[model samples]
Target: MMRSACALAACWWLPLSVPAAASPASAAEVLPPVIDVAGSIGIVTDYRFRGISLSDTHPSVQGSIVATHRSGAYAGISAYTLNGFGELGGSNLELDLYAGYRHNIGPVTVDAGLLYYAYPGSSGGSYEFIESYASLSARIGPATAKLSAAYSPPQDGLNGNGNLYLAGEVALPIRSTPATLRGRLGRSSGDTPLTPGGLYHEWLVGADYELGQVTLGAAITGTDIAAAEARAAGARPRDTRPTLSLTAALRF
Candidate 1:
């Protein structure tokens, strides 16, 4: 499962006071730009990854820190608490390291990144894996739409199998209000421990209200996996059931 975190982009401009006789080159010899650092912490009613619950339908705490450069390169680390099910070898923590670059071409914004998932203090075997993702997004009227794909190459952690996830999302901001409506539809295919059924569809409809640096969100999320399929996958009954989740997050 991935922890969704928002980072505040920042840019700094310093005014350099020069003498009247100073040349233009002397004014340009100021300090180099600094990297922007942003952080966030939040709590969720349930820790969901893709369509499955990693926290066994329980609440989870998550946090993240990201550093961004002016050149559109960014790196971040995030962690969340989970139940540490069989797939995780009883490890209760999920940590992710990711880096990517974002660029704008005409009216479209492109983002590509690599993410590494690590389960610390896990036993039995390694539960680490890597995935690469790319996305293109554009603004349409008051709504923003994006299409993304994530792929994991065949590796030992996945038992020599690979996985692919494709998704589309749309977010609309209410005019003259602090609320935003969001929706997503996703499909997961291929072999992976997360989806024992080999394929499944997940969907989410959510809304978020901003209150300064704090934001409150509520969502209804569910997957198409049947009860039997979920059980057979070592997942709890609630994993496949339509559920409501509440979150309170603070960004800085």
Candidate 2:
């Protein structure tokens, strides 16, 4: 368990899967530090990650308070809005939150943490279910390599199942230009394969361009989605199309 815990910490520092920093705020309002300080607030016009619309058809308010030090140890909370629950009016609007930490060992890093996903308004009162994630990674030259996994066990409306997500990617900078390209492939598995409880695979191949506070990226994911409603509506194949997503984010 200790080894696994450390491997999980390694996953956080490896740039391949880590999120970038936000726009700089006033020094008087907020102090920025190297290997210190922990907190941030920002908004994204759209919040889509790994081909799924995390904040569909609406703007998202995001906040994070995490800081890493020379020792590479840190902790923080990341929260965002969840538009839908994969069903029509099944649950009210939802919001998700996760707290993570990382520790470094030589060239390797480990990350681990618990995550909470909740729903508020509409149907039932505001409530949320929880999950967990652990990952490990290493770095080499300008390329940082990583292999991370997460387990979200079964729960009430979340279905009695857990998922294991495995992914790896590399990132490199473009000389003289403020841009980076990254490629990743990830697959998820669980107990069942349906609606909000299906085991499936996902692939992500994307790149991002960063200019100061604004950054943009695009990626595509392929999966099998059952379109029974479309089929019943006489829409060609019963299988839905693959998932493709493009994202533009600004941190200010």
Candidate 3:
């Protein structure tokens, strides 16, 4: 589960607007709750999660839709193409369901969530799992800093008592420009649904250009997974190496 969450962690840093779902109140009254609905569709040179290719180094189509409440609660679903490398019991698609809450306190934001990963038509393999996570974020000068931790309890497809992951990210917006620079670092401990071994690290550096409701992005992502580990896990070692990616997405 932690592995699944780490794979989609890139979505965490987006600065989404929170509009009021209810009417405004007088100065002496409390603000009413609000609701927001957002969705996006995109194509990527490769579907990389935690710096490993889930699309067999091939391009993939991805999309997500989320509904949020002004009170800081949200639920959403995401789906993406999967390749042989994803090892989803022969399934060619991956769907994720998630629910979470986020709250702002002063200049800092705190969040927690649960995610369920599903691979339909999979059999005789560890394919479905769940994870829980918590995170904190704050603006630091021109950059936003975030730290998160996620855990998965012992379940099918995982070894031992599951996995733990810690990650941090920094996002910087270029002054007067539509581009934002981002960097991520993460560490994984315990057995992952994909990798049944020791600890590993993942890293990514990227930039995104926003054009109205569309975004263009590219990144260099890599992981310190060894050949032996990949072999034991039935994964490709090359998939863990630094890879270049270009992506375009439309938001609605």
lDDT of each: 0.73, 0.47, 0.72
Q: Provide C-alpha RMSD values for all models, in order.
A: 4.3, 9.5, 5.3
Sort every candidate by TM-score, greatest first: 1, 3, 2
**What residue pairs are clashing in model 3?**
21-34, 21-35
Tens digits of per-residue lDDT for model 1, 28-57: 565334566777778887777776777777
**What TM-score would each prediction reach against the true structure?**
0.84, 0.62, 0.82
- The model with the greater TM-score, 1 or 2, is 1
Worst 10 residues of 3 by lDDT: 6-15
Name the candidate that leads on TM-score: 1
Give per-residue CA lDDT, model 2, range 1-252, as digits (tens).
Answer: 000111112112222222245334443234324355444444554444433344553465565555454345555445555454443244434444555667767788777777665554434432245657767667677767777776656654444545566667677667788777676665555552212224444455556677565556544443343455323322122121223223333222
Once model 3 is optimally superposed onto the true structure by TM-score, how far is the C-alpha of residue 183 displaced, in angstroms?
Answer: 0.3
Cα lDDT over the full model 2: 0.47
Q: Backbone clash tally for model 3? A: 2
TM-score of 1: 0.84
